[model samples]
Target: MRTSHKMDPVSLTGLGLGVISLTFQLFSGCLKAYNLLADARGMPAQFQYLRIRVRTEQHRLGNWALVANLTEQSGSLSTSLQLNEALVQEVLREQETILTSFWKVSHPHTLMIDDPKPGPVSGTEGEADLQERVPQSKSSLEDRALRFVEKMRRYPSRIRWSTFDRERLETSISQLSALNDAMMSLLDSQQQYKFHQAQIRTSMQVLHLNKKVDHLLQLFQANSMQLSMAQFSQNLRLLHSMQLSAYSSEPQEERQTLATLARFKALNVEINLDSDDERSNTSTGIFEQPPLDPRSCTIFSSVPSSYSPEEVRSDGIYENIPVWIEWKYYEPVLHIGHVDPHTQVRISRLSALLSNPQKPTQFHTPSCIGYFNDVSNYRFGLVFRRPIDVSSVGVPSSLFDLIISNEKPSLSMRVHLAHTLATAVQYLHSTDWLHKAFRSQNVVFFTNPGDTDISTPYLCGFGLSRPAQNTEMTEQPDSIPLYNLYRHPLAHSSIAVDGKSGFKKAFDVYSLGIVLLELALWMPLYRVLGVDDRNLQRSLQPGVTKKVRELLLRESRYLEMVKASAGDVFADVIRACVEGFGEEGESLHDKVVVRLETISI
Candidate 1:
């Protein structure tokens, strides 16, 4: 080239084109690599955002449910309160009118008249004085009667009468009657005109009228006092029933509505009460986004790094054999608070037992990896052999949501879930552990990649679990009545009647019965019973145990509905579990597992 050798134009052009093509290839490859790196870096942040969104949606749904319940309570309370107020007003008005009329009729008036001196006087002068006095007295009596009638025409506004005031009014009426009688006697004794007998009779009739008015006034006063007391009592009861404070200008109904709205707003739920269609649409959009991977998310960055060597083993060994790492990052799922030393020991023992592959006990449940203590905050981490989506785990969304959204699960899936739960309970019982907090909400579902056979069911709510003997000795009565819907009626009734905690293996079996019924009917307990959470709460009050027991019995409408929907086999299992067969040496969990195994999908 230095020598300036002459080159072909076509060859020079081919060389330039080839250089350009190579440069373009290098640039494209670099861009793709940069994109891959960026995605990898952003995944944690994206996962964190997804978790936040899922939590926000769950809070929104919870607030919406609360709002629905409050709205119902407001409607019922408003109707009853309004009716009671209207009736009270009507009775008050009628009683006031009666009292006013009686007061007017019994009112006293003053009269003036001239009389002759006590010394004897001439007959003509005495007769003149008497005639003048008679006319003046009659005119005064007529004027007083007119005034009383005019006063009676107006209704009385301030009619508050205490005992003293009532007595004074009665005395005044009696005095007025006595004065009328005296006036009538004076008129009857008048000799000015014997032919005025008709006038005398009219005066006597007026006197009799006074007596009648006095008697009526006394009766009205007594009746009015009784009515006032009755009204006061009724108002007190209404106030109690409304449960509203005197200082609050807002009605209970409005206050509850506002609180519900505020809660919805706090949860980031955009609700428009003006449009039902809009609300429905908004609710449907609540959980539209897919859940994030809890393991890869940075939300658990606050999780402590300190872990036992056994817990930190990266080889992922079960019985010394390698297995898939279901969970990559350890994170706290619940804040259990400062656990008792004994409880901590029990949990540690349980965790070790679960991780020991040498043990014959094996079930489809989450394995407790390890526990951490941060001051008063105690937490534990769990791991599964295969990764799972935590966002779709809770009962409100996984199980209840299916029924709420009108999505029916297949018969086989229900059977499988029921069988898995029974097996898990059986395993726990076999280990002499009691799951004191067993419920549908404690059951979780998982999915394994490339494994489309069946959804994995895990029994995971072991926060309240302990050795059977320990739980029996330290069991506390459940304070939440909503949970009682799943508990055995006898357990609830016995506790209510005797103030004792009736926690036993049979209690768990009864809860299983409720869950099985739920699975069979594809409905939540509240929905099946056609009641709200408030109704369930009210059912826990004193004297309501009997009624609740009757409602939960085998012949109750709830069971009848379940039997109609799920068939005889499922119903029989529920009945047997709920009403234990007093057989000795046979655990309820074992019986339940046996019954579940025999049921065909």
Candidate 2:
């Protein structure tokens, strides 16, 4: 061996050449142009539009043409060797330009201002009016809640030991206890505050819901709507089983199977759906908890008269489900920069009922059909349906995870989402009302994606829909506590008075576009990473919730990514949010007002 080394220079040179060739031969990933191949397929046509999401980083062969096989409803991906990463970036940049024109969302930390309180509602006629308006407590929303809670409680031991892990059960109980305690204390304080409020006015048009507290119980109890802890736990199970099984993102291959969450602090689905397609129910059990009613319940009672709805719902009280309209509602108290401590912010449920013209109630004795709010009494906060799902379901767990599977979603499904969302929004707009709070959860199955009327999209969380007439909606400061990254940006400023500072059809369009982007992108397109619910809530913590603002407004790396991925359509929209000001330094909050003015819609 030593003798051969002395004269092997030529051999060594050959070895070097071989090494160089191998390095140069590294295979580049094959990328073909994204095409709507599903438009022509034998499948039952699950969707209509042809949306596709191709990772710019992975698809470098920009020269390749998109070839579609309609019969297969898919494109056979192929590509010419692409050595230039720059060309791929360029292609992505071009696409971003298109996205910019359509999408715009508010920064999470953006400070929102609730306006001054609207006066009040008065008169015996108001009381009678309220009675005539409320629904027949027909849906028995509260009754359902109570029944659901009770049912879950019955099988506590079976449920608790049945789950894959029993540790979460103990922890969840602690959290639920904390939540219950906090809510009870808050309610007590709010009632005391409201009693003082009724004194300020004698003759008014609306009433605070606080005045008619018993009526709320009537609704909750009507059909045993209120759920016991265990039963509520069971309802959680129902929600899990009924969770939607579809994807609406940009990529054609990003379908994830997260768990369905039911707790108030959080909700998430954690299951291995990598190969399972049959879609069956997955249930987790919980231990039992005792049944408890509000003998200790206390709230505001300044009303001199009774609301008609309350009397009706309270009719034959013992026979009804002792539920609490335990529903949470909010109203924007917009008076931004007013410096007046007495008028800074507020939380008012009365205003919520008033805004919805469909509500049958009129001003009642203590509580009214219409409402007036005060900042000092109610805190400005959103009452979510459930707690935060901190199981961390939003992020991908691994590369081989279900998100990037061969069974990825299709374009037609994407298009159907757009069309359906549009149809739903059009309906709300037609009613002269806007869904100030828009998000994925807010939008749900309208006749089960399989249905065709496509007429009415069942929108939940109406609890947060506020009256934006003269009010401007401002989300909490810098936190995406109970939201997916995709929905953070749709939180923006809106108004009601044709021109008195309001959001117009365009804002709605922007929200829809972001939603479209969400469906197309699969994962949240513009996430304020590292700022999730656990460490990023306004009230939950002090410095943890740093408001991971969207870069569409700020010129950061995120903004670049937004431009690169969203293209020009939504890119332009990002520019607007980026500027953070109107054409002449006007507040962007007011920009929505101006935008509404210029558009016919």
Candidate 3:
């Protein structure tokens, strides 16, 4: 029986085919599972990267929209319109390219290994090939997207538009429209993929991506509106300028010019211009001309009388405005030595808001008095509302000076100062601003005529201030030792995963903590830590909390001074800040305020 059981060729072939089919099915299933796992792992990171990219793009788009609007509004559209429009089209094209690439990398085809031939056996090897290929494809896509984003960041500089070249404009528009179509297609595919994904988390991530895309679309719509407004403003300015020039050239055109001016007035357009004589004069002295009407002024040529030429520090220039300090009327004023075109626009906008009679005063920072420009330099001034002569109060120039003084401030005085400091910070936060350069030197002491319990602390030095929504991160130089001392350790360290150097509220809190520590211990940081300027700089090289703790613990005198002066609650607040508490979210500010309020003194 065994000898007669030799298998026929047909049976053997059929058996072999069945085994191959089974193996093929198993291999196919494994490949599908592998792809799913890979996607599950990779998609979240990709989405996160996409989110950052989108945010950056939104910021760039907003900036461009602002530029376009300002140019149009200022009647300079002819000079910039072509370039700006081309820029917009370029960004849109790049965005579409990124989306297309994202879709391809995120949605690879499912493996199919159903062939019954021996050639199909290579599909098993293909699985390994696919695994290797998918990652390479994803990585290449990411690299391309990143490079595109960087190119977009620098795209503004590359834009060269010639008004005579209608072909270029047409090409740009056509490219943009084609990109729009591609983006829509990619979106549709993403929607399909999202619908098919089984995991809730993955689906949610897809939903997030959809929201981001929708946001981008909304931003594009906003850009269009901004462009329109700019164009309208530009037209108005041009008409007014033309009418004025004609009126000045010919007395007979006076009536027509007046009528045109009246029409502009009816439309609420401002037509104020400097007199010819005023424009012709050239003076760069601190006080070359009388200040503008104080009531309507947003900048002044004044400062505290105590301010000396030596006290004048240059903060470089912003928008071509050379910023410096000067003395006027016994108060320290921020003096803009040159009010460039950009500065004029900002001043005009701010002046409009300040001119509103019903505007709330609580949210306002220091007020400006007036601005003037000689032929050589433009000047504007910001007057400090509260000016303190630290010398009058038996203290030095600033809170920093008081900290280093051998004389210790009373605990009650310390409490009042801390409360005032917290309140000022709370006020700034409420007004949606961050005092990025918050430090003891920035805090000035002012005594109210009748109130004598404690000197009022005013948060001055707004040179580095910015909106909370758009905080800036700056690199600290080795020469700027003050920043090194007051800045959050995380700011200098590489621990932040976000790679952000911008100041945060928590960073403000940390700076406040150091100030409080000085206030509490009644000693400068360098003195309390028993370190020289060199050691102080070195100490900041380590982690903030650990380094601070070591410095506090290493010196018994520091503990004694803090405990003896500020007590436990104040000490705890300082510790919490040093530990990086209250660094995030809206609630942290409230929490800090509550914590400060709870402190008895």
lDDT of 1 by residue, 288-379 (tens): 12222224312122222121112211213333322222221223334643445544444444444444433322345555444333332233
Error of 3 at 472 (Å): 6.6
The segments of candidate 2 whose C-alpha lies over 4 angstroms from its true place after superposition are 1-326, 329-409, 446-457, 472-505, 525-601
User: Candidate 3 at 30: error in angstroms?
Assistant: 59
Q: Which residue ranges in model 1 land beyond 4 Å of their true spot?
A: 1-339, 359-362, 374-406, 447-454, 471-475, 489-502, 533-549, 583-591
Model 3 RMSD in angstroms: 23.3
C-alpha TM-scores of all predictions? 0.38, 0.26, 0.38
Candidate order (TM-score): 1, 3, 2
Error of 2 at 195 (Å): 58
lDDT at 210 for candidate 1?
19
Better of 2 and 3 by TM-score: 3
Cα error of candidate 1 at position 237, Å: 91
Name the runs in model 3 displaced over 4 angstroms. Answer: 1-365, 370-381, 385-397, 447-453, 471-479, 493-501, 532-560, 583-591
lDDT tens digits by residue: candidate 3, 1-601: 0010112223324543221121112212222222222222122221222222233222222222332332211233234344443333333434333322222323242222122232211232212122221112222322333343332222111111111222222232233223322222222333322222211112122212221222222222222221234443543453343231111112112212222222222111111112224321222112212334433323323322121232322222223333223221121224743444434433343333232333223323333332333223323443222222332331114577555543665787787777677656654443334566677776654432233334555455554454443312222322344455666655555344124435567777777778888888776676665666555555544444336644554556665667767787677667666555543322333445445656665
